[model samples]
Target: PVPVLLNYIYSPSTSMFVSLLSVDLPKPTLTVEPESSVFSGESVTLKCEIKGYDGWTYQWYKQDKQSRWSAVSQSEYYTVNRDTLTIRADAVIHGDQYRCSGERHDRLTSSQYSDFVTLTINALPTATLTVEPEGPVFTGGSVTLKCEIQSHSNWRYQWYKGSSRTAVSQSETNTFTIRSAADQDQYWCRGERDDRPSSSQPSNTVTLTVKGEAKAVLSIKPDKHVFRGEAVTLRCDIQWGRDTECKYSWYKEANTLYSSSTTQEFRFSPAEESHSGNYTCSGEDIGNSGYSQSSDAVTLTVTEGPVFSGESVTLKCEIQSHSNWRYQWYKGSRRTAVSQSQTNTFTIRSAADQDQDQYWCRGERDYRPTSSQPSNTVTLTVKGKISNFPLPQMSTYLMFGTPKVLYLIENNAKT
Candidate 1:
């Protein structure tokens, strides 16, 4: 006893560390996100939060209308990821109650079930997005995207890029515009509000192929003023593109004239007046760059007039630069067809009121569909045949009245 007392007295100024245990269970809080009431097809997130504690695994429960609770199973409609539960609202989930409880990892302790969070799902509306002036979407151009919902009023708009969770744009109006779109992307939208059924289902995604450019330079070979039978060529050049890897769309006024995939030039071996018009060009995507800008209009004019025939007297409707031409000869102001042949020619063999009329000729080829200018008119005048006749006889009642008697007297005198 004396030795024990001496040992206890020797233990001086010892500090002991002890941990206190808590018997009170942690209570979790359940919160419904994107509003408690939502439209069908909309996603509702239930977050279970337990404050002032760590290392807790959560279990979610849903109460049936019979007041019976059941563990939520993972499925297409319901998803559980850690402390969060996501429900895709549909017709069956109109009125549902949810609760959550936590289990600790460090010790064999659990949290009390959180208060119930009721969810009300309404019928979802159809949200659709449309693009104005639908066609090929150009880069650096304003793209107006409009969202329409099946029901509800005073709805606003929210725009998203691809499947991202964040909104790229939000507006009070139902229209979202991409001002000066610089690049291509997949865009989608939905209708939203500050009241119940906050957002509708996302609209179908629209894939926009935005090119970096919309400008081009269109040029014509030789000159904008072309002559018949002259070889003409039109070339569309994109500033940031290669000739081989790009395609071009050609327009005359508002009509599409041609589309070329291999070459940058639209060729006209022999230009015609029909080929003359205001032309524009756009270059399609080359590598990562988008279409080239539409080029400034280049006006093409074909000068048409008579091409002189080699022989003036021949009056031939001949086009020397072409082959397989069908020539037609016309006469008078009515353009009456006098003759038609491979080489149209007009020659006056006889003269008459109708025969001595103005004449002209023209050459046409059907192979490439071309018609030449008309030739100068020619006129003809005819005369009757000539015949030999005796000279004028002496007047019957004049000084030479007795021509026969005088002739006889002169004969007798000569004898």
Candidate 2:
């Protein structure tokens, strides 16, 4: 027994070195994003990678069950071309369980699984909104306002006046009737999704203003100082009435002188003696009695008188009392160019010794006349002709036949 123990103890102390190589496990990375919680129908991509392993083979595995695993059937689906492995996740396949395993030489390394990702799919709802007017909108006219949402499953409407929010519609129906015109108020509409509102852009505003009735008034400019044989006009202006089918009428002494069934100026050209009277005007109202009051009467005066200058003028008018009388002019009791009208200026064209005869202006008319009165007398004298002077004593001497003394007197007379 001593010999057997000695032999065992005599064996040399041999050392054995052992090293453990660390091959990193393949880690599954998410290259693609999952569907967002807010939006739906999205796409996702996943990739797997492993470090510390060169020239290593890879395999992809999906973990649907908590503890079980399944190989991805399609090699392209797993996409393990290199150390990095990628895969896609659609809307239907949202939940997790993805991993990658690596192998170096003949030894298999452990695997890394990806974190859980979720997916959701949603369908956008059909939505639209519109407005309707009950009737044609005119300026100052009443109208009905209607808001219509055609088919909005989960949407709301907002009504606005200018930049201010007026009303909101939770349900489908949104309408408002306005008895007044759009000029009274401005309106527009907007839409929103769910309870929270989106960016709102209002519709274009509609404006309305309607016209009512027409009105008119009369404006007249009358003459302050009117003269005979002078023309005048009565102007009719439609200040508030309709321009179409407007009429006018002018009257003198309560008698209509002119009536126009349209808008016109009634003009009197070269006014006469009878026209020297009261005048007024009135406006007709739609086949009814006149509405506006008559204008103040304008008076016209007829003046007749003679203006002249003469000597010894006994203006003989063959008649009686003179009242409202007109006058005429005469030369040598013969009528002149003057009428029964007033002359502003009168002058004799030729002044001769014959003009020294009696000349005067007399007043006359159809009713009566005035007696001619003598003006200052004028004496006519012949110049440079003493022989033309008549002498009674000389005429008796000349009548007797010529004696020697008569011949001497004749020679003296000739001298």
Candidate 3:
């Protein structure tokens, strides 16, 4: 091909020769609407435009953080127009780059690629609210509501009660404390960053139900009237619910007999008069709230029976508020009708060695043969018999008779 010189003359005040050369190609410019910064599940539009150009085909490319680039295709996460790309879904990966370029009908004529624009997807932090001391709580108890964010720090907390959109509490901390919890108090919580106005979705609602205070009851194992030197057990029972791990306390009259005991049964071996008094019990919950209301008072009476030997001892059957009672005594498993009087008293006059045996007493009404519950068994100890010795015969007045009679015989012998 011979190079032919081609020139054109244009007059602009003077005639100048211009050579025919290659034409200049236009470069496309890409701009994203609403900026490249957006939250997840939001839509963004990418537009590629070339000035002074028409009938151009547009192509979009995407690059990830791993330095990999691929041509974008129409899918659930994205859609393509002639010169604009729409991100339809909020599933865009973070730190992704997007760009577009235009091509004309002539393959040789193409526009330079636009500057890369990074797509930053800000993921909303997750929040969860939990209650302390799970399960039903008692009224007037302390409880805490804690909000947790998924691996995020420096987040302010927002607390909501029931379905109300208004926040009950807002603070940099993630916990909400209820010093005295009330019934039917429902709560929810969320988290937000101080720098961002948007907040995470509200957490699941938690409904709090409060229970009434528990009552303690005191029970005695054997009869309330026990004999001295008998084993007795005082049990404290809770009627509200069953909790074996609850702490219990026992009180005798105005004094605290036992405190902070795991066992509900208070044992008294060989019960004495001192153990007989007004007894009450109380219980505490798992949170160690103040002790429950004191139980009804139970009166215990301990009576002494034939405890010594060779002594007059009275065996009384002590009954609670009853008159005109007859007393029946038992000696070594042998029942003996002792008396029928206003007072139930059985006296053992001059108690001998044979009286050393187990004795018990019961109260009976003169009108009926029925007897009350048997009293505790008491063993009586009697002293052994003592022996007597006769006095020895002695010679007397021998010294006085010796002076008068001059001859007197005195005999000292055991007869």
Candidate 4:
């Protein structure tokens, strides 16, 4: 197609039109809105002004990496109305150049192309963080650590355990637990944002010391013999060289036994044969380490004499060996009523049939083990008038469900 000009005339005889064009106007001037600056999510307006232009149509073009200009306006990201065009800045506008060209009557002679105008969109700010624990856990445990920053925000957050960065979480919050005691290793967290010229200031650290599991060390006084019905105290101790906020517990065999944070002694009303077994103590440091090792075992023993039930008999508790010792007595095994004493002898007020069962004693020392042996078996014979009724050779008979009665003669003779 031939180029069209402003001075085209109609020739009726030849059925054609001639063109005449003139170039006398200055180039269009391009001015960016907002003084050539905008934030990443903001908009920018470009205005084109051309003098001496009539019936003008405007088109906008953007610059490419090779400095070449291409028409992109009149579509998305660009709007045209009269001589003004507006655009939304995307990530592509880091160093973009734009132009607005004007043309009138399609002559193309006096048309104007705008000067190169650069577009600058500021980057967005970003924030991110990392923590320890890596995962969930019990209240008290150790943790390792890790972290990274967000895109362009120039700010950072400092890690903290409780109030100090010296004990920050190691990784994501899931990575570690801060209860028992803070981690043994060094720790820190840094906050950084891209907007600021300098790095972010660290936050104050939160030092953490979680309470650990319960444990105790136990010691019994006087491992040797003790008198019946005497008082004895069991002491349970805990150790965490630097941490004193630990909890303590005492146990007998598999049972949970007792609990305390700082109670040193377990007082007993009285010592008896019922208290002859191994006892343990444990301590827990809630400040970071969970639990502690158990204390050494201790033994308690009580010696007493044998007593007879249902008959008048003498009861005594004695050491099988010649070791000097004390003794204690118990009607049954469960109840311990008397505190351990220095005397080796214990006497029942009255020997009855209930006291005829086997009984034994043990020895104890406050600082060491006390020695004691099982007492020799003693038989308590009923010495009342009618005590010989149940003999194998006796044909005893009762009337109307009444108990049978028998008479026994003195000098070990039965009647």
Candidate 5:
């Protein structure tokens, strides 16, 4: 154990045996004060700058993000102030690298090492929350809540609703409109900035369900005066809660008589009057709240009955999906065609009382509804013939044991 000569320093132009012993040294320049482009709750400030020199003693250096080169220790995102280092969390320094050096107030030493500064933590923008015409949202309308932030512009918006820290609305333009919305809601969004991690990271919970504006009722079942061939079913009632789904549209005087349908029936087996008119129905309930307020019309009238002229009447003309039909027969108008048959029955025969009136029929088939909407008007009525009454005097008598029959009537003179 014989060695006593420590703190050794000998560096004469790179002969090397140095702990640190200066004579000519000044290179410190580290700099980075609001300049390294930061964001996660930012607070940067680095400055070393040696230039003319002033009684030094500072020290800090790092390379990190795994390129490894340590010595800037103060932990938890740094704060070593002598020449100033203070980074305090830009989400813990991304891609980290920094430098600084000093040690001269006559401790004889070093200054050089500074150039390395590199940090860019800009990842705190995301705030999503979308629904500007994209949801079932409907309780009186008006819903536009898009706060989608990703970083391309200034950003200043905050809106929250469900867990409520209280913000419901605040905008520079990310959008937030609510007017009359009711029934269900949840929303979220946050993004604001003057600089640094000023806020962001609260989006992803947009519910906004709100539905209760549906009311379509059009129901025609078995009544509304129908009888051409009988069989009509048109139901479109609307509910809106327990699995209430819809997408049907069928109208008739307001136009569009369509029904490729999505359930809720609309049948018509032989229903005439050209399917009668004034009917209404609508209910598109899936999202974005569009069709549902249109249903009280219902005036379908098909009717036809009254036949007694000697009783033979039979005008039928059917085309239930086609088979050869070609029967016309109209008598009131249709330019009065009266008979062009393939025999779908048009018999009148035993009438003779001037045959009565109003009849109708149609069926011509080149296929697709080629002419078949007239039917349902049969009215015929004619009655005459019945007269002859004259019976007065007659007398006959026969008698035998207990049998006697007689009838006599004759009036003359007094009594």
Candidate 6:
């Protein structure tokens, strides 16, 4: 009797019962540390993470080339943590697909597999360090260190000192410039790419041997003693240093002949008496502040010897050391001891043809016979001579006739 009443009592709300069931969670995300593409032998970390969740056990899977998925185990090439995996050895092979999934520890709910991530291994490029001006460098000189990576252009460079890992300089370009290089400068370089942000192996270490400041030697082309109006060329040579390009400065005693010159050869078209002083030169490396030591003083002797005939000529004996000197003149290798002047000049007034001879002078001081080096010989040439013309024939016949006429006139006047 109750069954008929119960069958008619079913409500629509009874069919809407709340169902309690577990919802499928979102898949975990897998990412590689640094980048997916990395150089072989470089350490890399693979991380599996589930956002906004805790106490999740992560399982990592690597898919082979045959499209078969298998669980990864801890081995020499891999170190497996709870949610992270590390590749320890040289990762040479490529095309390994990886995925990760997470499971809740309490509810035993599993998440779907993450999107596949592929790893690409590349061989590290070889880095080489090269120096500019490969010879021995000098102090305070500019030097460039170039890092070369063959077949690679998009690379950043890092320079380091000897055996030191700390980077002394970093540049987007490959070259590292040093404005003022010092002694004991050693360097090495490494190259890195921005895409992977991993550094290649260190390049060969390059040791920079900085030499000391070089001493410059000044030399004169031809003899230092040059005739007047002759061209003279002075050269500044730095024989020992790497800095061959230098600015030259020429000095005549205390006066500066040229303030700055890029050429090592200082030329004088027509050397004059003013250029007869003690000349010296110093060299400075281009773009450097310090100058080399002054060269040895060179004595430039300029003499003017041959003179025109019948002209008043003076023979001067000059010395670079002291002005106080007595002059003794010589003619044709004969020293004229009788005539001595306290001054350095010996003058010949009204020079005759006999005076045309080789003349030289020597210096003496304090009436001492000891003389300095003999001056260069100078020949004097006398030019013109007097001319005598024969006197006109005397008019003897006309003179006799005039005398006889005068006598006859005197006799007639007396008669």
- Give the number of the best model, judged by TM-score: 6
| Whole-structure CA lDDT of model 6 | 0.69
Q: Candidate 6 residues 1-415, lDDT tens each?
A: 0112222333478855444444456678899875645777677788999887888888888887789999986988888899998877475356778888988879858888999888887777778899886776666767788999885567888999877779999989999988777856679999887655456777888888877766778888777877556788988887645445678888998689996788889888676545677888888766444457778888887544234444566655565554466667778967555357887666676677888877666676664334566655655656563234322211100001211110000000000
Best first by lDDT, ranked: 6, 3, 5, 1, 4, 2
| Local error of candidate 3 at residue 305 (angstroms) | 6.9
Clash-forming residue pairs, model 1: 211-290, 212-290, 214-292, 214-293, 214-294, 215-292, 215-293
RMSD of candidate 6 to true structure, Å: 17.9
lDDT of 1 by residue, 293-385 (tens): 789999997643221111112344445455777777776887666777775444443333445445556667786547666654433322232
Clashing pairs in 3: 41-90
Q: Give Cα-based local distance difference scores for all models.
A: 0.66, 0.41, 0.68, 0.52, 0.67, 0.69
Off by over 4 Å in 3: 1-37, 40-123, 196-198, 222-225, 237-247, 253-263, 286-291, 296-415
By TM-score, how accurate is candidate 5? 0.37
**lDDT winner between candidates 1 and 4:** 1
| Per-candidate total of colliding backbone pairs | 7, 11, 1, 102, 1, 1
With a 3 Å backbone cut-off (N, CA, C), the pairs that clash in candidate 5 are: 41-197
* Worst 10 contiguous positions by lDDT, candidate 6: 406-415
Regions more than 4 Å wrong, model 2: 1-31, 34-39, 65-67, 75-92, 110-415
For residue 308, model 3's alpha carbon misses the true position, in angstroms, by 16
lDDT of 5 by residue, 1-415 (tens): 2234447677999998867433456678778888746776677888887877688877887876678777876778777766787877643567777777888867667877878877777777788888766657557656778888776567789898888888877878888887657758687889887755677878898788877676789889888877556789988887654343468888889898885378887888777646767889888755434456778899987644333334445555554554666777777655667778776766665554666667656667686656655555554544543234332221111111111111111111111
- Scored against the true structure, residue 190 in model 6 reaches a CA lDDT of 92
User: lDDT per residue, candidate 3, 225-331, as tens digits?
Assistant: 88666789999987534333578899998689999998889999787755778999988764625246679999987654333333455554555534565656677
Q: What TM-score would each prediction reach against the true structure?
A: 0.34, 0.24, 0.51, 0.36, 0.37, 0.52
